[model samples]
Target: MKRLLILPLLALSLIACEKDDDSTTNDPGNNGNSNPSALTNNMISVGTDSTSLNKYSAYVATDVNTNKTYFDIFIYKDDVLDRKQYMLLHLTEIPTASKTLNWQSGANAPGAIKADEFVIYPKVNDKRWFGVYSVSGYETTGTMQATVNNGKLTLSYEDIELADEFISVNVTERKKCSGKLTFLLSDLQGLTTTAQTLDLVAE
Candidate 1:
């Protein structure tokens, strides 16, 4: 499979996806709820199609300066996710603790999460290019985990194997799509040289 869609530059046209490394952008004041408190039952199921993640907004960008932090995470129902109807989860290197990254397919190095770079633009009063879609943790083989304790962040993945390079614009072919993306890390508001975004950014 040719999962070469690193987008116009990790997200958007082909949908944003940027994962950089040499690590060390973990902020949120270093976890343990410095101010965390808002989102409750957060959810993100790709294939079986589940939705819960609410109006949490966070867009921290860095690439113009470079401590290399391009973390983005935004859920939607009204607007925000690059113009509405979205589910952007772009994180590269910013998890202060608890780790696990092992994607395949067209693997975008730097903490890996390449290909289409984890995107989606489901409809809720539409906006994001009308009908958008993506979920490339390398596209096939998966395991992009992050579970920072205390400050309660929980991004996850599993069997992911839907093909065509794990999907870039394929809508829904459902072969595999795991989930579990809770929130906290003092409510992420963090990246780049560059990566992705969501209702969760910490690249």
Candidate 2:
């Protein structure tokens, strides 16, 4: 009788131990790091429009080595995302005298420009609204761009060129500007939908 009773007790103890192990493995919250397999790729956001042009801004950062760069997109009516970008370049790579490139209000093809009412502020404090002599112009190397949505503004060569670069925005205040609610990029690697409000203007 003693031997038989001991055998059952041992089996019950083994079952209890197995249950504990299974519980731990199924608890996803216990894992401190996010599971990479569940993440979306190349995530981006189409920002909300503001009442004042100076009130609208965004910043994007990417790793050139990773071949994943940030392209600033403008959101138009009817859920259309404009790919004609007002991009920020790393000015260090630009050569002297500047060159021409493409220019658009957003991330898609560009339309006509109301040249008289345009301004490009390289730094946030600079108050010089240069005219768009050429829609597609080049700038000095290593010059980054920031875009603002304040009606009409001038654009130059250094303002609209592409380089082998990547960017991330410092969105910390433009959260409640106006327009539509913020949405994250459903594509791209290691990106998120959690809204960030930063003011990074493009050249």
Candidate 3:
């Protein structure tokens, strides 16, 4: 009789263990190491010396289920105060350590579907307005490379040129507006939050 009771108790214990294991595996709170959704809400501001030109901002967002990544860049004209240019890129995966991102144009690109890519929106004139020069012409070209190591992020841009009409922005400019940024990422925990603004001065 005691053996029979022991068998039943053992069976119950095994069933409970299985249920606990299943519950842990299916838990929604288990977001591995990164929360793409949270990361999407974060924003990074890139500052330049040309205060009257434009202000630049970048964002990293992702959908883990679909394994899709969204990179967004915003250019706001300080003087206009009513118009802003936006550029967004969609990729198969979020940039974790290091990767090269290509520029995509058109109305069908990743962020394009949501009207988040290559768009200009009107804004109300406000004293706090800031902006970055429009790089609309070079949308089809250029590469963005980034690296993350030891909690430091390095972002570099290459071969990014301006349109003929806007050539003056580059002419006689020794820097040519191409440069790399290096900053600490201690504040950007889990890569889901925004780090502090970094200088993006040309050169």
TM-score, each model? Answer: 0.24, 0.17, 0.33
* Candidates in order: C-alpha RMSD to true structure: 18.1, 26.3, 22.6
Among these predicted structures, which one has the highest lDDT? 1
Per-residue CA lDDT of model 2 for 1-203, tens digit only, reads 00111121221122123211111111111102212223221111112211212111222333234434332222222211221222211111111222322222221111121112111212111111111222333221222121212321112222121111111121111111001112222211112222122221322
| Clashes (candidate 3) | 5
Q: What are the lDDT figures for the candidates, one per model? A: 0.40, 0.20, 0.30
**1 or 3, which is superior by lDDT?**
1
What's the TM for model 2?
Answer: 0.17
Candidate 2: misplaced stretches above 4 Å?
1-52, 61-67, 73-99, 103-203
Position 70, candidate 3: lDDT: 47
Largest TM-score belongs to which candidate? 3
Residue pairs in collision within model 3: 54-131, 54-132, 55-131, 55-132, 76-131
User: Candidate 2, overall lDDT?
Assistant: 0.20
Worst 10 residues of 1 by lDDT: 26-35
Tell me model 3's lDDT, rounded to 2 decimals.
0.30
